[model samples]
Target: MRRDPEPLLNIKANAEAPADARPPGERDPYLTHLGERIRSLRATRGMSRKDLARGAGVSERYLANLETGTGNASVLLLRQVAGALDVPLPVVLAEVDGHADPAGQEGQGGHRAAEFSQLVQWLAQLPAGDLARVREAARHALSPSESRDARRRRIALIGLRGAGKSTLGRALAAAEDIPFIELNAAIEQEAGASLSEIHSLYGQAAYRRYEMRALERVLREHDTMVLATPGSLVSEPATFNLLLSRCYTVWVRTSPEEHMARVVAQGDMRPMEGNREAMTDLRRILQARTPLYSRADVSIDTSGQDADSSLRALRAQLPHAD
Candidate 1:
């Protein structure tokens, strides 16, 4: 009797189905998306596995595993990769909003990942000036007009840790007779843990989620309040963009020396403890964040000014309530 070839063909077909070809529900969707994002980012940078591994200080095998969605990446490794890519760490770990499943149709999370990948490729070719214009245009297209009543009364103070956002924001809120909310404190309350505990136990991604939740809660509960945001809040584009769109943002800036002095005066030495390059790092951070910070509606330099004077200057710059 002649043997049938259909059985062999079926076996070959089954063997050829890759792990990714498995049912969408069978795979870890988040890890798959993360791998795709990392691979896309690496491709955009024109880096190979060897190059990226070397830059990220990981083995090529590990990089390959990550790119294939087979490796569990630690937060520290993600941070190292983000640094090597010259992007904010959150960028690596961020998911495309609304993307519950990457295998769905357009308008679902699946198309979003594709669209985001295309957008990144398109953006990589633009010059610096064009990129800035595009960013502004996107912000305008996505954000509502500045005349919203909710935005008018909600004042947000943004700056480094010791730039007097809290102290000045407290005084200003008291003078204005409105609620004053420290965003970090709100986040801690939301997470039912302190900031340090949140970061230690849940990592940066969890902290950011808590931060966003807290911000949303505050915005929902208070139509009028003064908010002092975490210094690194600006590093997360989505959260920072929301802050910019929802509140009247003011950058409370100061000299690096003054920032350091004030932090020390407040009995906080973490920025300087065991770090000889503290001032140098501070300057670098301020320099890198200047563009983002400068996007604020108003800026007040607190250097060489007393608290009362700074508060007065801030008030003068504010858009008074209707």
Candidate 2:
């Protein structure tokens, strides 16, 4: 159900459209609520997507899109899905009245395979009015000072390496007169070596340690700055969640072909020299991370777009980009 290329995709005329057409975070209220209830109940049962799909007599992809607020399930289908979760149909229907958030509205666009975290499960359990109250309390808590400009707090650009996060982030920062931070560079500085050397000498575990420490300092030192983040950042769930919680994130996306070309143009010839399945591997990464990346506050598709074009799209998404 993922857009595959854009930040969000419109429902299509094809068979896959029902699940993919509606953006994950934006779906019909009743349907969205029902989907969350289904998802949450399914999680508590420790059932995998395949298991539930088989039991419900539905395709795995349909179940996935349904859980993400993307698929449109019929009353009969809901009954099947409810049965699969071993919950009564009436219970599922009534719980749909709960009106909990489907996902982050701020993160409008898009990774994960279709799994709900414990946090999502807890959030879904709140009553209708309690959801709003909790959000209000969170707003007050997160923005401790009333006068602080939320727009100017922090804007992080996340995407595949060739998705133009670096290029667009630098331009946006220049236009906004804010600092531009490259997280990878900071990590290298902290480790006293290049990223390759750090990975080769100390391994990924050490590199992640340096990454988290560098990320903390940047968030602390700069109140307002545009940053280009590593695509692999989503692999570190804790840090990725922390990044989403603290900053207004944007997923900058482009086609896999474009990503490979851009990376090659930037002098990284490993894709061309090393792996024959480079494009396939890149596509797999994009697909696997879509759920995690969907946590971003917004998105901008840089595919076939020039610097000025992409910048304009980004600026429209974030006012501070100006």
Candidate 3:
């Protein structure tokens, strides 16, 4: 069954509730866990509270209040803290279980939790190649047979921004008489907020959660559609794997120069604003992500080509192109 958007909305709603709403002496488990998680992550990074406060753009006094579980932080503050901690927002928000219980004071639930932790530790030590094999094995072992039989007509285009994904995706879908969906737009609709607002309010982790849910809903609802995903969608392994397994994946390739040119042509100049090394940074990012993007089933370079020309080339690369 498709889960409703209420759960994600509830996270924000619950987080933003006034601290006074609780009894004067009662501690919020959620806030307590969040505070401890932040402190632990900062300690692991060998940072002081002052350091974290500066990084997060908050005052030390406010941070201290949060760590002591005496402050009610706004979502924006938490987002900044998550960014400063160099971890996803979900990690910061994750409840810290088993800490209150002493060693050997565990019930059946605790025992099972320990076993799960041990399994994760064991898996973490495996070689990269072995890990991939283990993942595939586990996936096949657990997945329903029907899930393995995905429709080939469901196409997904993945690449960096300005690679002509949106442009070519619409053309291809129109040519084939199919629905076209932009994954980011779907996420925004699901969240009831813009992408920037999502990041500003809930951080990247929340955005990622919404992204996954939106994708799942789309897949469940549409058996055959063209999905134009966000540029960084490839960075999330689970989401990308689901995409690869279910869709005819395509990497819309273009030269770095052309990528910049297209973005400029679109009148969004934020890429080159105030950064002399913008092109260099873009190249570095592209290089780092190439291996991941290369996992697509097909690739098409649209450099130096008009949208019509690119559309024709992309269409030819699709399955059963006439």
Candidate achieving the largest lDDT: 1
State TM-scores per candidate.
0.66, 0.55, 0.63
Off by over 4 Å in 3: 1-103, 107-128, 138-149, 269-272
Reference-based lDDT, residue 44, model 1: 30
Q: Rank the candidates by lDDT, best first.
A: 1, 3, 2
- In the order shown, the candidates' Cα RMSDs to the true structure are 11.7, 15.5, 13.8
Q: 1-322 in candidate 3: lDDT tens per residue?
A: 9865664335555455443356777776667876776665543332345545865889999998787776654653565566677555655554435343456577666665556666665776799999978977875555433332354678899998889999999999899999999999999989999986886687666887899899989998998899999877776777877777788899998998988888789976443455576686567557756877888889999989999999988888877733
| Residue pairs with backbone atoms closer than 3 Å in model 3 (clashes) | none
lDDT of each: 0.77, 0.71, 0.75
Which candidate wins on TM-score?
A: 1
lDDT digits (tens) for residues 1-322 of candidate 2: 7644632222232223333234545676656776777765543332345656866779999998888766554543555566677655555554222332466432212122112233455667789789867855665466424222553468899987799999999999999899999999989888899987875577556777998888888888888899889877876755676677667789999998999899889987432346576676566667767766776788899989999999999999984423
- Alpha-carbon deviation at 306 in model 2, angstroms: 0.6
Model 1 residue runs over 4 Å out of place are 1-110, 144-146
**lDDT score, residue 43, model 3?**
39
Q: Show model 2 residue runs off by greater than 4 Å.
A: 1-152, 269-273, 319-322
Clashing pairs in 1: none
Put the candidates in TM-score order, highest first. Answer: 1, 3, 2
